[model samples]
Target: MKTVCCCTVLLLLVLIPTCCHGGNILVFPTEGSHWINMEILLKALHSRGHNVTIARASKTWYIKDNPLYYKTFIVPVEQSLVDGDFLKKMFSVFIKLEQGTLTLTSFFQMAIGLLDKKLNIYNSVSSFVPALLDNVELMRKLNETKFDLVLTDPCWGNGAILAKYMNLPLVYNVRWLMPEEAHFAIAPSPLSYIPMTGSGLTDKMTFFQRVKNIILYLMTAIQSTFASKFVYQPLCEKYLGPDCDFNQIQNDADIWLMRTDFVFDYPRPTMPNVVYMGGFHCKPPEPLPDDMEEFVQSSGEHGVIIMSISTFVNELPEDLADGIAAAFAKLPQKVIWSFRGPKPSTLGNNTLLTEWMPQKDLVGHPKVKLFVSQGGTNGVQEALCHGVPVVGFPLVYDQYDNLLRLQEKGGAKILTLRAVDTDDGFLKAMQEVLNEPSYRQNMQRLSRLHRDQPMKPIDTALFWIEYVIRHKGAAHLKAQSNRMPWYVYHSVDVVLFLTGAVMLTLLATVMFIRCLWKSVCRRKVKLE
Candidate 1:
């Protein structure tokens, strides 16, 4: 008994030191669907014994106080940046924009309206910068915490600012960095082959398609510049000082846990510090609830179809919803749709409508034949991970772009809102995906490739996080290109320098020939 007690004590001593070595991590997360994956990451960190402290706004929409896993440092705010109502309104506008039959005037009006809404959102988010930085007590507490690093979602912009202010290494769990894709900010994104977000083009482009890609890229660049100059620059000057540029600091993160995979995304140049952990949140599905399992089992030979547009959407327009319902009624398969708001008048008895459903679990189920999605990153990645073919109804933002990649790979098909609103369009799109074996085959191939990595994406991300903690930061892995000016990074200055040198050399050669010609003429005259 005494020998056993001694062995137990020795084990405890060894384990205690392991627990004590866990890193102190600070997190600044974005609200809405982004937080879903971020929460998964935070939980993983906590499970590994790391101490996590989140900085959340007092009026945040999604981030809530969680004492069990991580501590919350709430920063007081006048109002929340986003809420359910705001999302609903924005989605309504997006639906209208997608389904609207636009003339020239209407298109211009829509563009202006979108620009106004974007500016408003930027201003709302930027408001938190001053509110958090101006709080003396909060700043003091944060400094005293002495966190090893700041893990953040750069979509909010405030995270980058906060990291800079804290003087800690920044690591991003990111896909989009407000106003553009994260890769555009830090990596070499060549416009010729690499499709721009919202362009709806593929890597394999024709002449006109490449033109469209370049135009879309330029427009996005213009928007990004405007956001940096007007929205983020003033805040940086006031809080971080005059010499601090928003663009430099925005790309200053030591590691970028990019929520993208080469298997799903187009092949493009990437950076050393940018780690691809695209579907890190995805895992094998757990058993469904008893009732849900029973429903899935009842489908039998015909199989089941899961439909979800993700959290941002509460419901579709009445007519659109009715069309979808009537189409589902015609099909033999059972449908599980995640929806809220009023039920469609034509909802079939075979269809189950709930406020929420276990999306990833449903997609991973063996009986699931098809996945109807709204083309959000998480949903698309989940579908890819589960080897389910998708019929995407893209509404706004990067949804179109995300779906386009899947379509290009032959794993999914995209149906516009206008198409879905048409009489037989949604039904036809669904039938195409269901009847075709190629869709399933291609998606399964992609799933295999995505899963064939040396290590699981989440494990890879965790290793890099620990790597950063051990080394203090990943400064050696970062590229110097982030520090270079635009002209230097793009080699515009070098191109101009080379052009000038060539012109001078040509002139000098011409002058020497002219002088030789004159001397030859003089010698001939003297001989005469």
Candidate 2:
């Protein structure tokens, strides 16, 4: 009995150190704003006694604001590719192309420039690759510090590669739907699958849209394969060693942290590793500003409209702005527009325009009845968290998809830019959304569902992170993709083709046997 007790004590000593000295977390966020939410997650982990470190791009503004929170490192690649006269020329050509005023030769030149522009855009957003590599080298030099896990914003460039090179368990935090992995991650949307978003639409052919979708899918598949092989693989090989297989690394990731709620998306089969940590941006209710509070109380229960195009739509077209100003000028209720640029002179006394506003704070205000937004995923989550019905004007990427889900839920109205160009269209859409009580009620229902979650999103995220640390790695949660061939991975098409082939073979065999049997029977009768 004493020997057993001693052994148990020894085991406890070993495990206590291993478990209590929680593993270090390496975070690579796409931008400063992403870090804000990540910081909250890290704080939650810290409360549970985990050591966390942030390795982020230097140009990110949040780094400067909160130096104590992170161990900062500068990336070698320049964040912006174009400056001075070159940028001006590119912008001028792009504007002309957009307006359909460019000559054929100029159009070709613009096309080449646009391709270059895509690279530039990627560079501006994902220049952290070099810096992350530097961090790896720094870790190697220290020899004492080894990270147990890597948490990266998969929206940025090549974070998966870095995680692989480190041989650390990776948890991808996807801010939006990944174009390359959309079919596997979520249901394929016609818009993303057709013409590949930026390609020009041609009117010459029948069933052209379906053809376009097929072609785009094939092209995207090829491009994704190449990116995995050439870009992502080479980086891993260069840092980790020559023996590392990039394909295997993707399969080895511990989890995919999806910022999507089941309430918003339709039911779909997801891997065990894929966790829904949506609505991390949600905050508890707070008091509104004194002036705003006074206004809300004095309005005799008349509601307010909150309008913002989100950060991506920072440069709204003058025509669109004018249309919005004109529409709002005629409205009876107070309108608060979070315009990023100079205040438009056309807005009437009932409307207020500001360069910046506390978005969550404004959304939670009792007077805010409706939200007019560009349908950014984060903005939509915030609106839903605050029980504000939306008037979504989706601009690009998955914004359209997000709004479609909300509209289908009967909690929002979708106003496409194409329709919003006309004054009557904009006014009618706004009136329809604002005057309807069902929209408000539906939003409230969703808000209640979100609030009644089993656990806070931040807490859930932290628990998973710690769970991984406690277990050394939650590798058991990872999906086993390496065992299956590509055909088997997406086997619905293969199964149909195989079934057809088998049926044809059986039919042919039956016909041949019937012919042979008839010939034999005829010969026997003749002989008799």
Candidate 3:
């Protein structure tokens, strides 16, 4: 036994030279389902023998501590974050945006409410800097930890400051289909072609849609600039000192683990550092608990309709639930809804309503025929993995963009609930999706492509992560565009230079022509 122990130690020592044992990855993910996406990546890394540490906001840390990480840092939850109905209000705003029916006054009203709530929440997040600044001991303790990389969702922008303060490399965990700042950081996507999030347009745009896409991109850019100047930059200056700017550190990331994939998207350009791990959350269907299995099996030939609204949002209205319930009752299928709060009075016998269900597992089940969802990125990705067609009832954030992707894929139809007064439209939309054979065919095609990828999303993520650690930051993978100024990146400077040269040449040519005309006239007069 002693000899065997000695041999094991020797083997480990020899392997150390050739292999990267593991890396210490610090992940600071945003609130809600975005954290779930990051945890999937982190948990996978942890299983592969990497030491992972997580820092979470106290506001949303409702569950017990995660055992996947070596340590969990619980930041003191700010009042602004904890004390707002941001998600609920944001969902309310999105209810107005279904099918582009939102009027200017109502849209502006919702926008103002959402912006005010978000600014407060993000202001508190930005105060992460001030908290670090005020507590030297905390900062010292954090700095003392020999972290190799800083992994975070860049939505808050505070993570960039944290990475800058720690002098560590960054790896962005983008939870949206793609965040605008992320493209600003690394990719050279043209505003003319690449549709911005919330545009409700796909990559294949008509002339009018492209114009609209351009307008949306410009609007988003303006909003981001204003926020940086007023909100984020000032906070960084206050805590990170005056020299520190939020944007300077945005692209400082060594890698981007973007939650997007080509199978679910149109063909588009992506940089080497940008890894599309869209279906990372997708896992083999876990065994359904006894009740869920019984409910699904009971459905028989009718199958089931799944209405899972992802996470952390207000429940559907009771009346709308009744209307949806009524529609499901009329069909031969069973319905499983992951709803919160009280059960609707009009819920049907065929519909086995649960407050929550194992979404991925049910979607993968042979009995689940169609998914009726809020069209969250994760939910959409989950649906695509199982070949389940969707009846998308999109709400706030990237839901519209996600739904548009599905619509383009021909596997889903929009169920607009813009007006709160009715559910007639939703019922018809649900029926339309269910009755269509093409939806099922397209979804199956997507599922096959997703599964038949060169490598599984998880494996791809693991490879790239280990590659980064082995090469020490992998700085060479960064695009040249990441280093260019905004003016130079968009070629605004080149346009100006070319315009000036053209104006000068035109002026000189006109002068020479007029002069020659005058000289010819004088010569003709002399000859006469």
Best by lDDT: 1
Worst lDDT window (10 residues) for model 2?
A: 196-205
Model 3 lDDT at residue 226: 68
- Could you report the Cα RMSD, in angstroms, for every candidate shown? 2.0, 6.6, 3.5
* Candidate 1 RMSD to the real structure: 2.0
* Model 1, span 107-139: residue lDDT tens: 687678767887988998888888888999998
**Shift in Å, residue 323, candidate 1:** 0.6
Ranking the candidates on lDDT from highest down gives 1, 3, 2
Off by over 4 Å in 1: 1-13, 101-110, 421-423
**Best candidate, TM-score:** 1
Reference-based TM-score of each model: 0.95, 0.78, 0.89
lDDT per residue as tens, model 2, 1-528: 999999999999988986766767777665534555667666666666666677655454444434444454444454432233444455445434443456889888777876676555554543455555666566664235677888876654466667766667787776532245332433323443223432333212247665776686677667556555645566667767787766566556576777776777655556776777888867876777777666556555567788887453445566657768878877777888888665555678778777776788888888888889877777898888778898886655556667766787788888766455564677788888888889988988988888888898767777777667667677787655554556776686789899999999999999999999999999999999
Screening candidate 2 with a backbone cut-off below 3 angstroms (N, C-alpha, C), the clashing residue pairs are none
TM-score of candidate 3 on Cα atoms, chains taken together = 0.89
Q: Which is superior by TM-score, 1 or 2? A: 1
The TM-score that candidate 2 achieves is: 0.78
Return whichever of 2 and 3 wins on lDDT: 3
lDDT of candidate 1 at residue 321, scale 0 to 100: 85
